[model samples]
Target: MSNIFTEAEIAYLESQPLGRLATVGPGGRPHVAPVGVFYDPQADAVVVAGHAGSGFGGSRKFRDAQAHPEVAYVVDDLASLDPWQPRGIEIRGTAETFSDGGEELGARITGVMPFDAAWLRIRACRVLAWGIDGDSFELSARDVA
Candidate 1:
């Protein structure tokens, strides 16, 4: 219904290149892994390139997302070690797997993977952010488009 990301949140997303993606696997198991991520402002979603894996046909994250679209992704950092200021955003959304020609990859993550990678696009349903706006935080449940 409204954009869950503020100007600062978007800036943070742009500044960060890595995030943790969490997904559910068989037997109700939770799987989380570090991944290269980029925020697609045009899509209003987080984009992650899928790496080819030996057993799963794609990365574990891709398979997990395919099986269970509901997932959570977080990108965070310690803004101040002494003051203990932790800044980050958690995105809860449904993931959609698709093929990409690698054109969407940005310079921030281009050297991290190969071209023609599969992609997981997470459309945000809820967003929670903290320390992104000088210690202010908020949660948005409406569709962010």
Candidate 2:
């Protein structure tokens, strides 16, 4: 599907790193963690990378993607708690695990985080975003909106 965000908004979110990643466990449980991401404009997808050794539920998510591809991620800029300074991005998608092209994927992911050479890939299906300021929260873009 085409992205809901304008290229400008997408570029803003992509400029920030450290997003919260959400995945499902084997038992259909939800999992969340902070992660670095690489956004590919060409594919209109976000790729997340993690080391095989990190063992922080990434493996399970990768495995789960094989059976169920649904997933979500959030990127928030909380550097300033000032309500008006809040800028965040939320992404929901069908994920696919790809390992055959580790080197290439790693290279792309590494551009986001230098230590991300050992992770697998999760391609985002949808993305939502909002910019919050002291006065109000405006929807920049979202699949649901």
lDDT of each: 0.75, 0.60
Name the candidate that leads on TM-score: 1
Q: Which 10 consecutive positions of candidate 1 have the poorest summed lDDT?
A: 49-58
* lDDT tens per residue, model 1, 27-135: 7899999986677766667887754332223678888999999999999998888877888888999999875544445333444545344677888888878888767
Clashing pairs in 1: 1-143
Q: lDDT tens digits, residues 1-145, model 2?
A: 3354566556666678678778787788887867775666556667766653454334666666666777887877754665446677777776766655544655554443333234444455455566632222666544542
- Model 2: lDDT equals 0.60
Clashes in model 2: which pairs?
Answer: 50-119, 84-133, 84-134, 93-125
| Model 2 regions more than 4 Å off | 1-4, 51-58, 108-125, 132-136
Clashing pairs counted in every model: 1, 4
Those runs of model 1 whose alpha carbons end farther than 4 Å from true positions after fitting are 50-57, 103-115, 136-145
